[model samples]
Target: MYENNLLLERGAARDLPETILLSDFLLDCQVRNFSPRTVQSYKSNLKYFLSRHPIRISPEDLKVFLVHIRDEKGFAQSTVENYFAALSSFNDFLEWEGVIERNVVPQFRKRYLRQYKDQRNEERQLINLEQMRDLIDSAEWICHKAMFVFFAKTGIRRQELIDLDVQDLHVSKRYAVLKPHAKRSNRIVFFDDECAQVLETWLKWRYNRKIRISALFIGVQGSRISRDAVYEAVTEHGLQLGFHNPEGLLNEKFTPHCFRHWFTTWLRRAGCPRAIIQELRGDTRKEAIDIYDHITQDELKEDYLKYIPKLGIKL
Candidate 1:
């Protein structure tokens, strides 16, 4: 029995190649039922790290890798953070498998990445109500108009908007059921009559086209719109209306995300309650009080209709 126990312990502690470890870690991610996108992200990040440093991961080597990505490769702060997150998850897996005594990625992040304040929020473009109207009106295509109104009124992320299906919308109800997203806490978003009208017109036009796809929005070829296409459509209209400047700073340029900023800002200007705005924006409840503050869908819709600005879209 003593010899058998020794053999079990030795097998448990057997050394594995870094590549084998990475494959195992990824398999663990799959076993946990992580989304395909998430699993792909982990695989990509780990593969890049392994390609650079083919040996065992150490805190010092990790630091060097991070510096190389941040400084030499000029990756954005968010991208760098994503890389760190992948590494941290992998380290946790290693520690769980007894490959390491403890995970050090959290400590490394606190000592390095967590010190800087993210200024992207501060530098986001803020357009006024009239300018928003101009942007909607200037759209050459009905699809573009509907998309802009949806973004400005709903304040959903680009990916969320793109993921919307035809069945998710209730045109008469002036509401939409957004697809599941990691960051979005609430899946419901409401729009005003102006937005509804534009959407109805787009739907009619889309029906005329007779595209059989389930996507709420589509391209010229009757396929679900790509992310780049959405970006281009928004930017094109923004430039035409002088709301976007490609040569300007982050604050001076209007992007699809700017609509979300506009929605939040205007809702506050209209004196919407913080909790109501939070619910409408699908923001995660972070505090203990937030957990108990349950605002009903009816209340949310009532406040939303009262606060959502009128763009006077003449469709």
Candidate 2:
């Protein structure tokens, strides 16, 4: 029996409603410390699925739903894939809970990536060092300013950024463990002395406030910051630093993810080896593990320092 906890509402029924089951699944995700953004996506997607189908769905119904979503609803391949992923997860949960005897869904997952390869954005957008400095300097809070520096120096995803904790930073070593969130891998990301100084300033403020959260970055409300808040803040400042690009459809300056792209571009321009760049960028480890297996964090930091962003402009 699932307990009334977190977002789950209380009910007086022995048999769990689909609503309660979904709530339980979300709680399970929270227990595993999944990102709030990811949990929200899963809940939204799976609820949409349940609205179309019953608590128990046949393989035929799943295939029909997939076809309807693709042809009638005209959902993009990627959106369909997201729906497929959430439904598959729900199916797995149901099977585990013994609510269903078998696990089968529309094979909406297969070939979605490969078939829509050209449709996706592979653009490697970049911003100049000057613009990077402006975004960092524009941040009002010292903590947000430090976070801006962290993004500019390290090519971590938004998910990975929020996953960061104070313990992850090693000032003496000039490196931080950028733990995996979403598609990223648990890896070391090194920042320069300049970023460290800014971070320490924020740390002093954070320590004085004494917020009881483990998150490295917190909002003015003294709580762990949400991913949407980070995105909005980064975009708000980044837009002032660079011009819009009509060709790419997404200007680097208008997105928090642009920092990661810019970091990769700068690292390559600095002549860091492809393998080292891949490691620092947290590329999909499925193929590059053999190449990076022997590499040490010390060696990586040496390479990281050689071409670290030199923003003379301070926050």
Candidate 3:
């Protein structure tokens, strides 16, 4: 009798509409400090699933939905995986809240989605030194030039770059402190004299404009620059130099992330030791030995300055 009662209670808990549960989940995401873009993505993916199925979902229902999206809707494999990820997260929430007896999405993914997953590796675009120099030189604005130089010098992720504030940068010291992130092992990144020169020029121009925002990079209205703006800026310069092709594969088009590849590749070529390069890249240490291998700031800066490539752009 107790077992039957427990089953009834679980069913009743799941009777709540999908929209209500989604709202609660999104609220929890906000409380956990998820970025706005990520929360919106979760919301959209869950809404699409709810449109086809009720909140009281079963493993069979999930399998059918995945098949429909992949086979009938003809979504890309990655996009299908994204939809499943959103559903899997929601299932975890349901299980945690006691609305469901167990989360089945994980098992379903392993059984159904794993077999079809793509295993091929994709290559990224890597421009040579002369091309990189020409790309930076062709930028019409000091701000764009500084941004390009900074990305090449620091090898930080795009979001990390966007999160920068004027206070985070120490121009005289030729280094900047990146914000804390789960994936980053180091918070400090150093720049060379060329990068510092371009940054100083941009800062001087920005200060004269009387912009009051603390962001290191700003849009026309003195607001923080968005990710889209950065992509467009990089693409514009890339296209002008015949380096970015809209109809090309991943390796054929130049993007902001390519700067990181260029940085890592050239530093390796310059004979910067593997440990030092990893430290400068801020990659999380995975090995047990990696945790014990400490690279001091001064040492890192010295090697970074020694190895970082120069673009030969006249200030």
lDDT of each: 0.86, 0.76, 0.87
Per-residue lDDT of 63-102 in model 2, one digit per residue for the tens? 7887889889999776887887788787777766667766
Clashing pairs in model 3, backbone N/Cα/C closer than 3 A? none
Estimate the overall C-alpha local distance difference test score of candidate 2.
Answer: 0.76
The candidate that wins on TM-score is 3
Structure candidate 1, residue pairs in collision: none
The 10-residue segment of model 2 with minimum total lDDT is 5-14
Ranking by lDDT: 3, 1, 2
Name every residue pair that clashes in candidate 2. none
Cα deviation of 239, candidate 1, in Å = 3.4
Point out where model 1 deviates above 4 Å: 1-24, 30-35, 118-121, 246-248, 286-293
Kindly list the per-residue Cα lDDT of model 3 for residues 85-182, writing each as its tens digit. 88888888888677877888889899888866655356888999999999888888888888999999899988888889999999999999998765
Candidate 1 vs 2: which has more lDDT:
1
Each candidate structure's TM-score, on Cα atoms with residue i matched to residue i, is: 0.86, 0.75, 0.87
